[model samples]
Target: MKEVKAFAPATVANVACGFDILGFAVDSPGDEIEMKLVDKPGIVIKDITGDEGRLSRDPRDNTATVSVYQFLERIGAEKAGIEVVLHKKMPFGSGLGSSSASTVAGAFAVNALFDNPLTTEELLPFAMEGERVACGAAHADNVAPALYGGFVLVRSYDPLDVVRLNVPEELCCAVVHPHIEVSTKDARNILRGEIPLVDAVRQWGNVGGLIAGLEQENYDLIGRSLQDVIVEPIRSMLIPGFDEVKRAAIYAGSMGTAISGSGPSVFSLCRGMDKAERIAKAKVEAFKSIGIESDMFVSKVNKVGPKIIY
Candidate 1:
């Protein structure tokens, strides 16, 4: 194929207990990219939408085009020219893995154009390179799930090991994105570099339980395992109405509530659509009560990651 258009779903990274390790994909509010072959060498950003001119037009600075450039270089196809157009359907800095969606869409579209030269795992590093440019960290919690879909675990980063985890069908996600921007850099900077051993042990236990719960399709265990003793304590303080929103979600029958990625956007996992909708409503109302406008998304886990649209 000479041209391909693809879509990558939005992802929730750091899923409470599994900080920098766990994430899952949601069905809506993602990014789309179209990659077309050209005669000139190198890639160019043809267009960008829904970003209100905040995103860079230069291919080197943009996450999606940067990923495409890296993919081309890795395949020894830098001499081949490509044009990429990005559509940012999700809000930026909303803890919704916006950059990851674009990066995955770009890399996946480029790979599809070349008749699939790399496996999904092989395409990860190229996508992570884009993430590093966008957020200053080569973390896979967001990108892995956006690329492979479902739930993912970043077992190790040194060698870049990632595993796709099982997700229960009844488990639904409710996410609320407040009308506020929180820089990922600022969020990372505010975190304490050290933690008590007791808290670390609790976090480890929760992470292990989460993994087992997912594998066994145990909804109650999953809810019980959704505990964050480290990051959320520090990060949620930066987000307005976070505490109120969490409490409201729980009262509305959510399994558990936590900051989605870093801050500003809070997510809850519910047992089904009915409870998910209730949690979304409660969270949004809580934010509104705190004088913040927000958008809520209720969805089951997206099983397919990035895919060709045309």
Candidate 2:
């Protein structure tokens, strides 16, 4: 095929206790990328939509094009020309893995168009490079799930070992994005450089419990494991009504609630779609009580990561 299009779903990074390590994808609100092979011998970003002109068209700067560029360079196909068009369906800085979705879409589309020189997991390094271009750090929590789908655990980053985890069928996600911007850099800067050993022990247990809960399909254990002792306490202060929102979600039958990635967006695990929707509404109302507008999404875990659209 001369051209191809792909879509990648938004992801929830961190997943509470597994900071910078765990993530899962959601069904709605994703990014799309269209890539067309050309004779120009260079990557060109022809268009970007739904970004409100905020995204860079330069291939080196934009996540979508940069991902494609990196993939081609890695494959020694830098001399091959490609044109990319990105559709940012989701909001930026929403802590919903916006850049990851775009980056995955671009990388997936180009790889498919090129007849799959790399496997889905093999495309991860290029996608991570795209993230590094977007932010200063190359984090795989968001990109891993967005590319691999379902739940993923970044077991180690040295050799870049990522493991896809089991997802409970009844587990649902409710995400609420308050209509406020949370700078990822600023949110990260506010975190404690070091924590007490007691907190570290608690966090390690919670992470282990979360993994077991997911594998065993134990919702109650999952609820108990959603506590964050290290990052949430500090970063949550940036999000207004965070405590109230969490309380509201739990009251609305949510298993647990935590800040999605950095701030502004909060996520909860629920038993089913009904509970997920209720939690979403409750979180929205909680934000409303604080005079903050918000956007909400309720979805079962997305098992399919990225799809070829054309």
Q: Which one is best on lDDT? A: 2
How many pairs collide in each candidate, listed in order? Answer: 0, 0
Number of backbone clashes in candidate 2: 0
Residue 204, model 1: lDDT of 98
RMSD of each: 1.0, 1.0
Worst 10 residues of 1 by lDDT: 65-74
| Candidate 1 residue spans exceeding 4 A from truth | none
lDDT agreement with native, every candidate: 0.91, 0.92
State candidate 1's TM-score: 0.98
- The residue-by-residue lDDT of candidate 2 on 74-165, one tens digit each, is 78888998888888899888899999999999889989988999988889999998899888889999999999999999999999999999
